[model samples]
Target: MELPEWHGPTDDAELDAIERKAFADSAALQLHLSNKSRIHDGVILEQEATEGAKSNQNHIALKDNGCGEFHRLRTRRLPDWSLLKRSCNEHRTKVKYPAIKFGGQIVYSRTALEAEKATNELLRLIKSNTHAHSGNEPFPMGLDIEWKPTFRRGERPRKAAVIQICVSRSHCFVMHIIHSGIPPLLRSLLEDNSFVKVGVGITNDATKMFKDHNINIGALEELSSLANLKLGGTAINWGLGSLTESLTSMELEKPYKIRCGNWEVNVLSKEQLLYAATDAYVSWYLHQILKRIPENSCGDEKPNQANAIA
Candidate 1:
């Protein structure tokens, strides 16, 4: 499990300015510790690594991973993300939220040729749609990925099995990449920076794409970052289901069975197709709503931190 990276002031000048402002305002910086013992130990080790000379010891040095995150190479332990996983699972319950469905046509492509044609059609829509963008603006598309679930411990997860993209409410393309290897044309489109892929935690999807298919997806716009910037509140992390509801007052229903179903199957069931299509459509639709919101419009609100099933 990957934790979100932290960005802090870089130089002493900026730090001094922050301290001066805090003193002038009679405010003190507050640090909240969720796990005191673990954090304290990690911090102590990190300080030692920075101040002490290199030693020929078998113990791994606690080093910063550029996000103020400390990691020991040989004694590393993966963080437990079950709580986050459970929060995501709760969003998928149909009983908790109303169902959100896409009325658009879902084009399922299983072969390399079919995927190429579908991708061409999607590109054509992006090129011709003046309503969505203007000169020199990136065409935004909702993107999501799915793979077969692995329950085995210490086993690497399977590669991405399905790639879903939607440029508008009228059409969505679900490419069964497990069956049809990523074709040259599809790779080209993904690598193109002109078309921006928008979704929650989309950077993770980009990483998975590179690891699995050797394809470097470019022009990614993370929905959470966009929301934090555009919504003009105390910056908060977001989840797809929660963000959709916040913007549109519409529930983005994600059924647990369909969401966790086998995406690598030869043929996707209607429920699976609808689930995939809706996820992409909601992402696109939410971006359309969020982009129009004027900055500093009293949009500040408590954030919903439920993890999106990306």
Candidate 2:
């Protein structure tokens, strides 16, 4: 399960930007707070909203552009993003998605959750997958992280190491490519004038965005919506396999034995690329199909897009 070295699984030129961004992130936020500065969550910010500021109070302004809303605060009263991150230890938080579980495994409901952004969730997922596989790096996204490139040979496993993810808006085409790595299928989506991304566990997807494609794509939602058609409903499958089965009625061909096929095989076989594309496009199509149906028919049931089953 150890990763081997190569030209590294990335292009240095491409990674340069990511490295810069990571560095800037570290610098922009402060770790220590003096008596003059304080840290608290949104709730604390609400409490500290008492009238005007003191004449001599030196304060740092804080804002969290999280979950579709921008929350701004003067550092004197609000939580410091860096502090919360330190407390969380960059841990991944599990959120709800519209997926199904069967045979002790969950299938991805891609369409239902395609609206979610993937880059927002990529770093955490990549870090987790690397750890699960016992990569050289213990944590993929922490301050001290290392990466060793390796490959899984032979018949690939269906449960190749992938943490299913969806975005807040399925329409973020660029972000999807960034999170999922540069799957050839994604390149096609980017070229297509009518391509769109759909899904639910977008935050998880965002974690892997950088490592996979070496791109941050901060504005994926806006870009995808402009290029592709988006459905207002929930994600169809939480992962690619379930999305394929639900939308195309065909079980996705599993590639790797212990992990998803070596996505970075460089010379990926046609069938492998086809399988990957199937996962992306089938879900896209299924979402479109379901969009044509009346909302009332979707039923009053409160469904989920987490861990979809094939």
Candidate 3:
């Protein structure tokens, strides 16, 4: 029997209906199984389970020999970070970058070693300048990520190509994740509570980092969250672009074409470097301005010293 060709379903209900229908039709079930690879078998099984539960059935018939249990177990297993790191390292090749100007100087970390060195230098600066002081002062660090754009439909999302951490206005360390995964020293700083990792949409970044690279980004201070708290009932979720404009009174230069450029490639264009650096730099700049505002100015009746990090 010739079964109808399936397009993508519109929603979970539609998908469930389709799955339920397919389960009753052998030809349609085979066609669905043929289109989806073995890796997607878990999704199929999950749909089957959902259908079964709705019908008050304990089990669903899998025409595929007894591999249902195995598939379920495999689906629950998370991707091993060590294996992923090794795989990336094996394919890793050194990439060069043209220095882009930041804080009155051209800056870029071309290699993993250079990135690590820059991170160390930034830590030293943080220790001497910020940490040395005694008070509830937060050591503010700007954080951002760059990823390759997905050009086609149904393509797997790209991993974070590079991660930029700006500890000081004059210094931004652009760590090449494809070339070198997050270094140990940098990881320490990221997890440290004393260092406030400030970014506009950092929750999404943190989720991606943990999901893709298995790196837990602690000490996150989301600027958007801070803005909401400061504004007191103003429903404003400002992105880096708009926030920078409002805070600094200067437009941030983020070209659309450059923003969508292939960040996973071996060599990064000068524009990409500048764009990544400026994002983190702006985050750092905005954090500085936001932290300095008195509690009363933001409509906080009580001085919340807990928000003050020092």
Best-fitting candidate, scored by TM-score: 1
- Relative to the true structure, how large is the alpha-carbon lDDT of every model? 0.63, 0.29, 0.56
What is the per-residue lDDT of model 2 for residues 184-256, given as tens digits with 9 covering 90 to 100?
Answer: 4333332333322343233334444444444332312221221122212222223344332222233444434
Model 3 Cα RMSD, 1 decimal: 21.6
Model 3: residue 108 alpha-carbon error in angstroms: 2.8
Q: List the candidates ranked by TM-score, beginning with the highest.
A: 1, 3, 2
TM-score to native of every candidate shown? 0.65, 0.29, 0.60
List where candidate 1 sits over 4 angstroms from the true fold: 1-97, 299-310
lDDT of 3 by residue, 123-194 (tens): 777877774444786677889998987757799999988898776644566677777777787777777788
Pick out the ten consecutive residues of candidate 3 with the lowest summed lDDT: 76-85
As for TM-score, the candidate ahead, 1 or 2, is 1
Better of 1 and 2 by lDDT: 1
Off by over 4 Å in 2: 1-196, 199-202, 211-214, 218-237, 257-259, 296-310
Q: Predictions ranked by lDDT, top down? A: 1, 3, 2
